[model samples]
Structures are given as C-alpha cells and as structure tokens.
Target: MENLPYGALAALVGLSGGLVLGLAARLGDFCTLGALESSIYGGDHRRLRLWGIVLGTAIAGCYLAQAAGYIDLSQTLYQSVRWNPWASIVGGLVFGYGMALAGNCGFGALARFGGGDLRSLVVVVVMAVFSFITLNGPLAPLRITLFPQIGAESSQNYADLISGLTGLPPLAIALPVAVLCFAWALSYAPLRRSPRRLVWGLLAGLAVVWAFVGTAWLADQSFGEVAIEGPSFTAPLGRTLIYLMTSTAGGITFSVGSVIGVMAGAFIGSSIRGLFRWEACEDPRELGRQVTGAALMGIGGVVALGCSVGQGVSAFATLAYSGPVTLACIGAGAVLGLRHLIGGFQPG
Candidate 1:
C-alpha cells in the first residue's frame, strides 16, 4: 500500500465509498432535504431517524478507528481548521435556504443528476463554479480576511475537549454518545421495520470512517497530496471540474474519485430500479430559481467549510465543534425556507 501512488490510492478509496453513498441515495432515498420535508410536512420520522443512524454510526466508527490507531483525527482538515461560529451560522443558513430553492444540496444534486435529472446538472455546475470562486478565486481574499481559518488555540475536537476536561480517554466519552444516538435511531419502530434503510444508513456512516482510515494510511505511508479526509462535495466538485478541463496539469484525487463514484453508483442504482430516464427543466422561472439557489449553495458551502453531508455527517464523525452548530443552523434555515414556500412566510 505504501508503494502505491498516493493520489491513485486515495481516489480508489474515495470511489469505493462514494459508490456506497450513491446507491444509498438512489435506492434507499437517503437525502437531507427529503428527510427534512418528510419529517416536517409529511408527518413522517423514518427518514430523519435514518439520518440519525448514519450520524451515530459515523461517530462510533470514527472514534473506534482512532482508538485502534487506524486514523489520526488531528491530521484531518476538520480538526485542523479553526471553528468559526459566525461562519458556520451564516454559511449554514445560506446553504440551507439554497437547498430549499434548488430542491437539493450539492450531494443531492449529484445523486439526482446520476438518476437522469438533467436539471440537476445545472445546479451541480453552478454550485461547483461558485464554490471555486469562494474557495480560491477572487472571493478567497475577502473570505480569509473575514473568517480567518486558523487552527484552534485549544484543541477544537470534542473528543479532545472531553478527554482534557474529565481526564477520560476521548474514546470513552465518544462511544457512549454514539451508542445513545444509535439507540434512539433504533427506538423508532418504523425505521427498524425497514431494514433496507437501516442498512444503507449504517453503510453511509461506515463510508466516512473508511475514507479517513484509508487516507490516513496513505499519508502515513507516503507524505504527499494525501490528506486525511472523508466525503465532501462542495470544493471537491469544483476541483473535479477543473481536473476535467486540465487533465495534463491536474492529478486525480480523492475528491475527483468521490464525485465520479457517486454519479456512477447512482447510475447503477437507478438502472437497477428501472428509474433511469432523461428529464429537463421546461420552465424558465424554475430554472432561474435553481441557478440562484445553486450559486448560494456554492458560496455558502465554501464559507461554511462544508455542505450538509460535509459538516453534518463527515465533520460530525470527527466530533468537531462546527458540525452540530452548523447543522442546527442549516436545519433552522431549512425550516424557515420551507415555511416561506408552503405558506408565503405569513405568520398566524
């Protein structure tokens, strides 16, 4: 494994996990917006509970992996970057509102595109472009000036904080929290009844852990471009697009493989389910709204440091402070956006 090209190994690792995510999205109907809509408007908790399973499983797997010395949390970007509350709130809210307008987050857009929704391709392209603009384009200077992503003075990791506070190993604290979440998810009888959803949720979480473990190993074996990371669509999508245009100069990376893997997996899943078909936006007004939403998602995701799956699941696995705060803001923003859509934002 050490002799393998770091970039190639990372891409393969990302591709393998992304395939699992893509299949889950298409067949299991695993989606953040869908879950929020179903739980809020449709009076259903199954999808939300499914999300819980994914979170719990991710937390448990990541912590356990660290305990086994399979990965190093400090090396991951999530842990290295300073946790900015303002950035999290502003970015999460913008991203959430954008998701409501676009009808999907970046990850969801990719998954939808894979299922033959050509409209989603527009969102994906716009989102990726805007993400790059904010991440490294002209906006980068302003973003850095305002948000200044420096490493935390004190360790920003939850596990580290707990370990220091209580003099208990971080794993000791993490395992219990993970178990509690898993228990809550399992407590929902409806979710348990649908074994397929449960399996997919678990697999999605495991995918995050697997990415960290694989990438960490590569980095340890050969210190190169390999950065310990997991699934995140915002910057990755932009990087993938750039790589496509400049193949000679650009090297394949985990992000590139993850993006391709999701589409490929979604394609397979859709084909298997006989749900593959060509679809496009026929309404100009709808297209306009999606483009606006996509732009917001791209900028917001970059500012927030991640989209839903990025912070909500992947960062959460690392127990980063930004995860829960950003996720809460996103959920709140989604609720507000949903209300505006459903009831014209008028209060009773």
Candidate 2:
C-alpha cells in the first residue's frame, strides 16, 4: 500500500487548490494587503472589508475543519519550538513590507499570474529562486551560521512569549482570541449589505486554508506515512526547484503540485471569464519595485519561514502560537513600508 500510486491523488488535490484560487481570484478580488492599501488610498470600503470578511470565514472554516477531523493540527510543524522566535516576527515584518512593494504575496503573486501579469512573473521567479537560495543554495550555510549567533534565547518563538506572559498553554489563549478577533473583524455592518461578495469571500478564505491542510495530508500519505504535518514554503520551494532539476527516489512533493496547479487553473479560469489580460511593466520604476520586492520576499520568507498565506492565514488558523505574532509583525511591517516607501498607496 505504501508503494501505491498516490502521485495522481496528490496532483488532484493540488489541482483543486489551484482551481479554488483561480475561481476566487476571478471572482472575489480578495487580497488583504492590497485591499487594505486600496482602501487607504481610494477610501473604498468594499475590497478592504471583503478582505476582513474572508479572514473571518477562513478562521471559522479552519476551526470547523479541525473539529470535523479533516486535520489534527497538533501534528503541524508550527508547534515545534526549536527555531528562532525573532525570525518569524522579523521575517514577517520584512515580508509584509516586500509584499506591499511587489503588490503581492505568495498567493497574491500566483493569483496575479492567472491574470497574465508579466511583472508578477518576474517577482514570482525571483522569489522562487531566492527562496531556494536561502533555504538550500549558497546561503544555507550562512543561515545556519548566523541564526543562532544573532538571536538571544529569549527570541525562541511567539508561543514561548505568550506562555510566559499569560502562564497558560499557548493554544488556550491563542485559539479563543483568534476567533474573537476574526468575529469582530467580520461584523462590520456595511459589509453585510452585499451578500454576493460576502459568500464569495467566505468560500475563497476556506479554499486557501483547506488547500494547505490537504497539502500536508498528501505529503503524509506519500510514503510509509509520517504523523508529522506542516505547511511552509521556504524549504518546500527549494525542494520543488531541486525536484525540477533532477528526478530522485524522494516522494512526491505537494509544493510542486500546488505551484503547477495554480498556473493551469489560472489559465483555465481566466479563459472562462474572458479576463485574460497580459500585463507588463511600462514604468522603469516598476522593474525596480519587482526586483526589490522579490529579494525582500525571498529573504524575509526564509527568516519568517513563510509568506503571508503561509503564516498570516494558514498557520494562524491552526492556532499555532507563532501565527498571531507573525501576523502582527507582518502587518506592522506593511504599515511601515506604506508610511515610508509607498505612502501614496493607502488602505481605507
């Protein structure tokens, strides 16, 4: 049974995720950072609040999924406390700033690719490559060398800090608070007026969360089956690149499946909606933004161990102690970038 053909199964899950992403992209137009930025500038509450509503739905869906036995989140890697705590927060901050600059995060970049955006192509390529470099390329040794040497013992992880502060199990405080915060965010009265967008936003949010949960599950089924489960990008991106370079005895990797499915799904969904617009950067400054944003995302993603979708949404719903901390730092970083570099880009 262990040797059974699970490759197709894995691909199917990945394809479903991509289709969900493309459908959401073509439908809801949800991206929190972008939506927030747009709101700040245009004073339009539609997209911004839609982002929040999506988040609320994602949180609710995640909890429901876990309760339904779709995922035993305790098996997730986020619970492991061996890594540097400061890294997640610091990395999230930098990644958030970079996301603002690139005008997209990991998921956002993938969604934009469906729209035939060439500038995003550049950003995604650089991000994937640099992600490889940081996780395993020439930079790997340097990361191992610098990480322990830089942060204090106190810089372990957000959960450690929370446990220290509240004297309770991290999950005890994190889960309840996350649910409450999401509920408050979604309860914005004006947003309830548009039921169509509300339904789309909720579905989009669930699609993203459950997609990763499925990825982790697929990975577990790939071999003799391991109990450990996690959804992260830094190492997975590097591994996916390596898999592309050479075929080996290692099991099927879900990241590769997920990445491929997004392109295919985007192609199909865009064609269906007649929203296929091939885009390129006309302004030279846009090129600079892409390069800078890509580099920042690569480095920051490695340090934080995830992009926005990975940490902010996916990991957060699991009630992982680090999730909230990383999200807050990421948001703060985005706020900083908007204040200093892209002040003209505001969120309503």
Candidate 3:
C-alpha cells in the first residue's frame, strides 16, 4: 500500500477477486443464465437460491463495509449515475436477450474461453469490440441522447433515499433486507443440501466486497485516478482488448487484472476438473447468431451502464435502485428469448 504503484495494487485487487469468481463459475457452477434457466424451466430452486445467497451476502458485506467506513457508495458508478428506470429496463432487456442468444454473457464467455471453448473466444472478441463502439465510438452519441445520465440530488443510492424518507439510518434498511434474503435462500431445502454451492456463493459475493474495499482504500490513500468500482465485465472487456493490442498505451488496472485472473482461474479449475477441451461452433448459422448476440450485449451493457455481473451483483451490493429492477428485466427478457428458441419461434 505504501510502496506499491497504484496500477499494480489495483491489478492485484482485481486478480484476487477474479480468482474467486472464476472458481465459483467452474467449481460451483454459479452462473446467471444457468440460474435463470433452471428456475424458469427445470423446476430447480437451488441455482436461483444460490444467486440469492450471493446477492444477500454482497448486500450485507457492502453495507457492513460502509458501516466500518471502508468504502463509500456515493463514489460508485451505480450511485453516481442518475436513476434511469426506463433505461435500466430497456437496457437490461436488450442485454439479457442478447445474452440468451449468445448462450453466455461477457463474464461467462470469458470463463468459457478460459476453459478451452473456442466459440466463446469469438463471442468475447465481438462483445468487447462492440462494447467499445458504444462506449466511445459511433454509438456513444445515440446512447447519450437516448439515456442521458445525471447525478442524484439528495441521496447517493436507494438505501439513502429510503433512509431519508423513513428517517432511519441507511444500514437500518440495508441490513434487514440482506438478512431476509439470506434467510430465504437458506430456507430452501435443496440449496441447504448443497453446502458447496452456498460456500461458493458466499465467496463470489465476498469477492465483490474485496474489490470495492481494496480499491476504495487505495483511492483514499493514494494520489491517482482511482475510481471506486467493483467487478464489471462490459467496458472492461473493451479496455482489456485494447490493452492487448497496445501494451504500453493502456497500463495495468483492476479491469485488466480481473479479466486475466478469471481466465487463469478458470483454466486452472478446468484442468483440475478434467474438463479442459477445445470446442468451436459447428455451424456458421450458430456463429452468426452468437455474433449478433455479442454485439447487442455490448451496446446494451453500455446503455444500461453494466452487465449481469456488474448490475446484478456489484450494483445490488450497493442497494442501488437500478440493480433489482434491471436484474428482473434481464430475467424477463431471457425468459422471452429462451421461450422463443424453445418454441421454434412460435407466438407465446
């Protein structure tokens, strides 16, 4: 902390969090799409409960960190961005539908690619490329015009909003919600049966907290451009892609470290699990669908301001207004896409 460069410290923080996330994906089989799919079609509550555990843990961990004065929610992007209900719904729908079409979100694609899935490489590349396009390229203007984001006036986040309305401490509202979520998730018999899933879900949530706390600490002490953030796999993907091409141009940061760490962790996990094998798309049509899906996810994520992991876990951790709403919309959109695919494009 005292001697290490800020960039190096940020990367180390990212790698630490990413390793936990990758292990969760590989060993725990924790995935947003998988959780949604099982709940919607397979009559399984375990995966969904697993997500609840993650979200609940994240919420508790974040608020606890705030309570301890470790991190500030006001500094985070989710809080900084003005509440945009319509944008969240629309962007989440687009991103979710695209995720279903591609068969994976950006984070999932990276994990797959790490596990020797060649098709996911294409998805990752296309998604990153288009994310950059929307982030700072041609689509930037349209996104800004359609969804102009402004800062909140009185509150930093929804918890603050509620706290102000009810005249209670923000943690007074956050802690109970987190506790109820954890209780509900643990009450599920099937999820209770899976201790490994529970542990990994906890680890996943803690990973986000780790990143937030570490970076916030660094920003507090160091004199650098340290934006308080957590794990997000959208614009970071684009940034990572660019960094790969020009090493000297973009220095090491949390996003770059996180991207590589997840891949490395996934690779290690895949090897340990004896699941390392190269796989590619067999049909061109499938490839086309995946590409289109990747593009939509890139654009949609920028518009929405985060991806599944970004908004789902990180934003939810902060109790941001957009988190739950966007998550629900994404789930709804995925259900619609999945239904269309399963029903052979028949009207619902």
Of the two candidates 2 and 3, the one with more favorable lDDT, higher being better, is: 3
Q: List the residue pairs that clash in candidate 2.
A: 36-347, 37-346, 39-347, 39-348, 40-346, 40-347, 40-348, 41-346, 85-156, 85-157
Order of the predicted models by lDDT, top scorer first: 1, 3, 2
Give a tens-digit lDDT track for model 3, residues 205-321. Answer: 999999999899888877537778899888899988888888754687889989888888888878889999999899887888789888888988888889999998899899988
Give the Å error, residue 346, model 2.
18
State model 2's lDDT: 0.65
What does the lDDT read for residue 25 in candidate 1?
A: 93
1 versus 3: better lDDT goes to: 1
Give the per-residue lDDT digits (tens) of candidate 1, residues 1-348: 657678888999999999999998988889999999999889988988888889899999998999999988877878888889999999999999888888899899999999999999999999999999998899999999988898756677888998998999989988888988888889999999999999989999998899989899888877646888889999899988988899733588899989999999899989999999999999887788788888888988999999999999999889999898888888887777777767753222
Model 2 collision count: 10
For candidate 2, lDDT tens digit of each residue in 1-348?
355456545555656665665566566666657776777777767766775665666655665666566765555556544455687777888888887787777667776787798888788777878887887678878866765433232323344367688897644544565566556556776667767667767776676666656755765665424323333444455555566777543445556666666666667767877888999999877778777877788888887767776676666666555676777887788777777665464321
Candidates' C-alpha lDDT: 0.88, 0.65, 0.87
Candidate 1, TM-score vs. the true structure? 0.96
RMSD of each: 2.4, 4.9, 2.0
Clashing pairs counted in every model: 0, 10, 0
Residue 20 lDDT, candidate 1, scale 0-100 = 92
Query: Which residues of candidate 2, in runs, are more than 4 Å off?
Result: 1-4, 81-83, 148-182, 212-252, 343-348
